[model samples]
Target: MKVNIRKWNGVAIWSWDVPKEEVCGICRASFDTTCSSCKFPGDQCPLVLGVCTHRFHTHCIEKWLEVETSKNLCPMCRQWFQEKTDDGDGGTGAHANTNVHSSDVVSTT
Candidate 1:
């Protein structure tokens, strides 16, 4: 599956859709923990990517953020970051971006 990464002139700038696989990032809970939540298999878990690009579930990343305050990096990458603030009241767990840059895209993989 692919969609045009459009340009200003309505031209397709880029096109990509990598096949998602069973990322071992998510902790194999006893059962499906992604219940009452939103996620898929291929799209990386934003949390794991925080430490590294190796994908995992959002919940998994949140847990890491809560536990490891000094470990500000993707579990796979060891990159440090300037953590952002919660965009809004994101429930018990706040939300923030990893500040990852476009140049860092390749390293995450």
Candidate 2:
């Protein structure tokens, strides 16, 4: 028997490494999906992992932190919000301060 192929279509799927049920604390959107403020998912709307072990969309957290009442605190645990960084010791250095303040963010509209 002989077979002849003319054309083929390929598709690929990708998802974040976080658990399927996990969602952004600020927007309550799944890790694989974009937050309410963004139009698309993936790198353009990246996720931020807090020192408190909570994750949120970068835009959501940035907007949240810009509020005077937020006080740069994590929405999930009420702890000071800071980005978790690798300390070169294989352990997370959660104490690194992001120093994000309301004044630091400029309002476009």
Candidate 3:
């Protein structure tokens, strides 16, 4: 099922929270431009894509997906996170939470 802006917005509103932005993956610089639709924090994790293509401030994904029982993945690519892994292990990083199946959540796209 596709989760439209209204739905995500409602969810965020029901929870009394807002989207996060500003913060780079490597340099910790404030993010000024990011596609809210396809870019998110996990997208900015130093553990992801190596070089950041997003500007989610690191808090957006952290606040939304970070949980003890929950494993956070890139909402955009649905790929596992990793800073720099060479031992393989599915290419997951040291801080990677776990694999998140795209079939599990409402599609934001």
Candidate 4:
């Protein structure tokens, strides 16, 4: 009898409270995984969504927003990315409830 085992270990898995399959529109990277430019996911490279219901890696969107051609619009939907308030209470006005997924509603953290 011969027994062979390559490797065995517990791997952590993470999921986002998104209706569609969790994937960053900008980098197309899974929400549980880091973008190509990032070495790791989570706080280091968190996921952020725009008012248009489009999602992307925080770093990825931040960089994209810096581009002169972006005009503060979402890449997928071209909707204005409503800026959040200073206290993170989201923005005021029409897009205040733009957030599709609420942490209080469905969060693993």
What is candidate 2's TM-score against the reference?
0.75
The C-alpha RMSD of each candidate to the native structure, in angstroms, is: 16.1, 7.6, 17.4, 10.9
- What C-alpha root-mean-square deviation, in Å, does candidate 1 show against the real structure? 16.1
Which lDDT tens digits does candidate 3 get at residues 27-68?
444444432432543334322232123323344455535664
Ranking by lDDT: 2, 4, 1, 3
Q: How many residue pairs clash (N, CA or C atoms closer than 3 angstroms) in each of the candidate models, in the order given?
A: 6, 0, 5, 0
**Which candidate would rank higher by TM-score, 2 or 3?**
2
lDDT value, residue 37 of candidate 1: 43
Q: Which candidate, 1 or 4, would have the higher TM-score against the true structure?
A: 4
lDDT of 2 by residue, 49-96 (tens): 877889889999999999999999898889988888776746476446
Lowest summed lDDT window (length 10), candidate 4? 84-93
Question: Total backbone clashes of model 1?
Answer: 6
lDDT for model 4 comes to 0.74
Model 2 bad stretches (over 4 Å): 1-6, 94-109
Question: In terms of lDDT, which candidate is strongest?
Answer: 2
lDDT of 1 by residue, 18-101 (tens): 223344343743122241244533233232333123544566656655666637555545565334344566521144543578
Deviation of model 3 at 63, angstroms: 1.5
The C-alpha local distance difference test score for the whole of candidate 1 amounts to 0.44
lDDT of 4 by residue, 1-109 (tens): 9989899898987666665566888888788788888897677887775555567888889988999999988888888875443344443335464466565587569
lDDT of 3 at 50: 26
lDDT score of residue 59 within candidate 1? 65
